[model samples]
Target: MEKLILTRLNVLGHPGRMAVFRLLMRRLPDAVPAGEIGQALAIKPSTLSVYLSALCGAGLIGQRREGTSILYSARAQAGGEIVDFLFNDCCRGRPETCAPVSRVFREGFPDMSDRKYNVLFICTGNSARSIFAETILRDQAGERFDVYSAGTRPYSQLDPFALEVLKAKGHDISGLRAKNVSEFCAPDAPQMDFVFTVCDQAANEECPAWEGQPVSAHWGMPDPVKAEGTDAQKSLAFQQAYGALRNRILSFTALPLDSLDRISLQKAVDDIARETPEVTT
Candidate 1:
């Protein structure tokens, strides 16, 4: 057996290959067709194939055949390694600088003192990533975080793939529905602690600023519903989105924020953002 080394994996070290890997990570467990990847990134199919091959060769991605099409997805266990590899060098050689942030999580959750930090995920359409993040985080974060999701302009219902992924993960979505962000911005809305935009359009759009001046973050994800393919192919997109959101939320909940001053807390949040894995739905 041969040992895997970073140098050997350097085939996946190119920016284009990394982009392809990020896309697969965002849509893990669901295989995306090469054509769609080419179209979305505007790379030539020949070029994209080379990058995809590099990922598959590195054991970071998997492939399956469906009739004439080949679908690709991130290998679940290997996916985490890729994520850690991207952030392993954080804080340089002096890791102790992160001690203040570490102490916060060591004290356990519910450390916020105030009611659990309220998080709202927003997108142009509430059908996909925003809704996925809402459900997954609520399940994983337990009672430590108050989670809500909405859209800048919502569709009439949840995306079926999104619903299916949540259900498969044992999250109850029986009463979940697409909602407009206006509902949260209304005069009677509950105060928010954080607001995240999960799509590029929503992140760039001008809207009424959050009333409480909630800390804002842009955690953009590719719109899984926009993925072109058969039902199963699109379903893969939802799964990938769920994986990426889960990874980001895990990092967020693991941060030590209880003891840090606002400045330090802000830096920790920035670190979380920088450390978040890039997903390509």
Candidate 2:
């Protein structure tokens, strides 16, 4: 390990290699052609080879022949290791002082933008609240999140009122469906990145094993469909749920998700959910 670290240091010491390495790191997970890399950095053919060879030899970069062109990319795992090694010994116990390594690469790393977070919203019935949340997040953060909803005891269908409310608000409900939490608990299911239990009932329910042990939180909201009243009153109830959810959803999306560590992000999500603005219905 000592020798490997020394080798990494030696490869990084050269200014030319460092420049190439930095560019590749920024373009990580997406391989850039060798010719384009050298041209962009104004590196001569011969000089680029020396730089690429050194970084490759040190496990700092990887390359593959793509037709006539060679594609080179930073070894993301290797870069992560290098950074971890730098701080692991010191940040072991004092976690507060440790900067978020994900944030450090968030902007520079193209893969961060390309990456999608899988978010699951859950409730007891999956009829109203969970459906609302899944659609809201799916539409708003569709590019950033793959949103889904499920219930421990899922209803046979979506709540008609929930669909009506979203439709009136100009939200697309074509893909909205009530799914069983069991479907997502399967080992073959796509691992969720974040899971929000959207109602008090589901929050307390014994949920099946989740795929990724995703960061879980409860964002309880009252069941709008449960309100028994006049037609006008019933309409207003759904509207209030929509407004309250919209407010919280906006706040949740406003967060710098890529910048915040898990702990901070969890706190932010919980705080947003807890802020149940006084809704009138």
Candidate 3:
């Protein structure tokens, strides 16, 4: 243990090696490609190779071969030990001195490895508003949520406006289709954690009960595809809807889902629609 600590300290003593270690540490639990690391630090390939070898030799960093790309990440366990050592020894008997530092590291990145929650967004036609909401939530927190979209009256095809706006915002439009709400009411549908209606009509409609009676909310937004205007005006309307859904999705992600109960969560989800910033083109 002492030898490993000494080796880690020695490796960190160099400016270049320490920079590389810091970069890798930021993206812990997610191995970054070697090219990304090199590009980030702007270190020459030959020199970066030597530093990486030193850190890897000390067991403070690890490398994994992912197909053709070599990925690198900080050794989390070892890194935590080193951080503890610094906190314990530097503070001596003054625990309060390092308390803030400890909190920052522990709380800065909350646990995001919870089991994925299945969510469905609904609208009148499942074309513009619902589809945009679905894609935004999926793109924002795909790690924690499995998202789907449906409508009370399903459309024959996806709305071109929704597709254009989503693609423009770098969302994956592959396999996105306009589906009906009845598909989820069937016996074999995946249970949902949350359901949101993105249009007033869908939210007000009397629909069949969901399987889990999932926590439902109304996040009504304008139907961009229904806008009767010139091409430029229609484009702006879609952009506005996209922005509104993006804001609400971000608010949803910020909630403490684990800590809130059903009633509280329902209120919280409902409040998102009421409190989110207004949408504009």
Candidate 4:
């Protein structure tokens, strides 16, 4: 029986099948059509069909016939099994190192139940650090709070290096765009809970006070795109920025907001802003 189970697992180890499975895992609940998967991965339809068939045969994916199209999604049980398999031997046999990250999803803000708490990151260009913070917060605190990012002066483009680093780390940034913060500070803007200036210039500049007099903080990061040197040196700058922001956001999300008073939470955010390490070469 053990041998038979190993044989079944081996079927999913194929590169093509693994790719299809990972894509489906990332897009749970949504049934991806066969053609879309092929296009996204640049796999030929005929080739993808073979891999999809293998996955279906192994019961790792579920297929639905929608009209003439066949849609596929990761089987929830199979997905769990895959995760277990991947991490079963991780941490060099230290079980504690494999614990899952925790998230908070509770009612009410730190003090005000009636007011919703929203976090907005502002920068001169919304292409790098601001965007990183926005996405990382969403990933870390998706259930408890709302997060957004924009620029005082919007850039015409996103830094390709930033996009590449995010993709390499398995974070999706599709449909994200650089927009001006003016859109949020307009008279009809949604009441912000916190406004974070993520660049030195934006932090120091005098701007219209946000609606509702939201608590403001400055979390400045050196502009990674401004790093000068070879291609590899510039790429390292983006990675350093990403790592620094990720660590700070991790610490911020771990705050015991539900138990802390408003004053405590404010102090905590300030300390977090002041103490996070500056990324460097």
Ordered by lDDT, highest first, the candidates read: 3, 2, 4, 1
Per-residue lDDT of 1-281 in model 1, one digit per residue for the tens?
Answer: 12343733575668888777766654432467888777766789889888888788778788889999998876656644433443344544233655544433222333468668898988989998998889878888858788899998899988888888888888999878999888998889887877777776675455466765565666777888898889988888888888888888888788675765554554455455557775634
Worst 10 residues of 1 by lDDT: 101-110
Which of candidates 1 and 2 is the stronger one according to TM-score?
Answer: 2
Q: After superposition, how far is residue 160 of candidate 3 from its true place, in Å?
A: 1.1
lDDT by residue (60-149, candidate 3, tens digit) is 899989899888877767877877777777776355788665554433322336668889998988888888888888878888899999
Q: How far does residue 95 in candidate 4 sit from its true spot (Å)?
A: 54
| Model 4 Cα lDDT, one tens digit per residue, 49-155 | 99988888777889999999989977757644444554554444344565431111112343646554688988889999999889888877877778889998889
The lowest-lDDT stretch of 10 consecutive residues in candidate 4 is 100-109
Cα-based TM-score, every candidate: 0.58, 0.59, 0.59, 0.58
Off by over 4 Å in 3: 1-114
lDDT for position 265 in model 1: 53
lDDT of 3: 0.78
lDDT of each: 0.72, 0.74, 0.78, 0.73
Which has the greatest lDDT? 3
